[model samples]
Target: MEEGKEDLETLGEQLYNRIYPSHKEIAGKLTGMLLELPGSVLIQMLQDESVLTGALEKALKALQLEQEPRLTNKNEDEVSVSSDSVGEQLFDLVDVYNTGYSQKITGMLLEQHKDAVLHLLSDPKLLEEQVNLALKTLKEQSVEETDVSDSSDTDDTERLGERLFSLVEQLDVLHANDITGMLLEMDPADLQQMLGDGAMLEAAVRKAQAALKTWN
Candidate 1:
């Protein structure tokens, strides 16, 4: 009986080393599972190396599958938290000079060039360049859309103004009123141009947002 027990322990050690040479805890668990089999089954496994290895491989695969979602979710959560922290740091840097435009600019950079924003977080100069590039793009878009024509009536213009106000609010609610007031101060024709054309209105709001600090 003692000899039989020693043989079982020896077989368990060999199985553990063969299956998980570098992971003692995992190997021990697998070895325990293997040892739980009936004497006849254990004897067959002990007789055929392929049978023991095959059973271990199947158990390991099932363990991996069971753990996949949990591992994936943990990694995803870590990445999300890391990304938000990086984004906030970048936003504060951009906000120093740009003020209210920081959120919009940072959001644009993340959307258009996410890899750069995340990977270059340590390089403030490069991040500033990215912010400048995003601002330049917004300016160019605004310039392109500024050529819109307007022929709407007073009521149509009022409705358009309300819609434009709402759109600008979506950019940053805290400064929406101030930005809308700034837009209101534009020349009658320019204001009409923005209100009448959706693209023009969006571009105008973005332009106004970028230039918001200058007027302050």
Candidate 2:
């Protein structure tokens, strides 16, 4: 049992390292865009939590996030569960599909890392092997072959904002912090001031809302 546990942890670490990099890099871009308002404007926008939540929901949906496949613990007939999917299952704690829950957890993460709760919105991977491994777990748990899209390009960070959003959704909070560190490339203060200024904030928000129209 101890050896089996070690193997699971080892596999989990390998998969986490592979996907976490892509997850963090992309998460910065999507989160940065949303939090792009001025502190004052953010103070104002913060008044409407639904808008914030909706923005988050919008970003994830754009990423083409599908419902996470349900996991089965026991074998069904000839089917057997695989240990590989432990990676995807590990993130079950972060239920981004639940808009309210996503918002709440994000808020909690941001507060602990005020950098996120206060200034990190404007923000802003393979992703392939890991995703395939995750899908493989589902296929193993059931007898039927899982019909997942085999295209890694489908969510490879170059497409629509949604494509990136889908990738970011896979991240847990620790990865969020790591991504923010890299995003220091862009000045949060500058972005914040740009949004806080009445005119700039208004303009950016308008542009963002307009972009959402094409999200469908």
Candidate 3:
């Protein structure tokens, strides 16, 4: 029975490694699935005080701990790192609006920069084009500004950017008309804050237009 239990645990570990690959954070999910297996089988295995069960629990805990650092590292990396410039950020904001999370972040942005948001939403294609231009400017700039005095402020900005970018990527996955409807309904202030600056706002609109032309 003990040997059989060991075999089961070994199989579970193998399955976990195959599914998660480099991501250890999914260990808890895998464990949850394992626990859902037939109760009778589990009980029968455990009747003899199996060491394999103990090992499995420990392995799951280890995976959780390993995953914690990776998650934290990912969040930290985003704070000081940006793929493009203020222009990219603008397109990213629109991108977020296309996603479900946009409402929350967009509401916050609208509370700060209502006019900009309205301008961007007025024409989705144009906004995307402008964003691409803004991104080009950011890329052209030699010096990257990464220093921030306030940690909280940095975190807030990072969160806003992430939410915005995630939305944009989601929009790219949707139908064009549905994407347009989502943008029209978003708050203007929110759009402005996500754009970060006036230049980015203009660039994003231009980029959107260019992209739309190519798509058509």
Q: Name the runs in model 2 displaced over 4 angstroms.
A: 1-186
Decreasing lDDT order of the candidates: 1, 3, 2
For each candidate, give its TM-score against the true structure: 0.32, 0.22, 0.21
RMSD of 3: 19.5
Q: Report the lDDT tens digits of candidate 2 across residue range 56-128.
A: 5554553433333332456543342221122122222233222222222332232223222212222122122
| Residues 77-136, model 1: lDDT tens digits | 454433344445555555533323555565565443444554445454576567677767
lDDT of 3 by residue, 24-75 (tens): 6766575444443444444443443453354355445433433433213455
Worst 10 residues of 3 by lDDT: 80-89
Specify the highest-TM-score model's number. Answer: 1
Model 1 stretches astray by more than 4 angstroms: 1-83, 112-115, 149-216
Which ranking of candidates, highest TM-score first?
1, 2, 3
RMSD over all Cα atoms, model 2: 22.5
What is the lDDT for 199 in model 1? 86
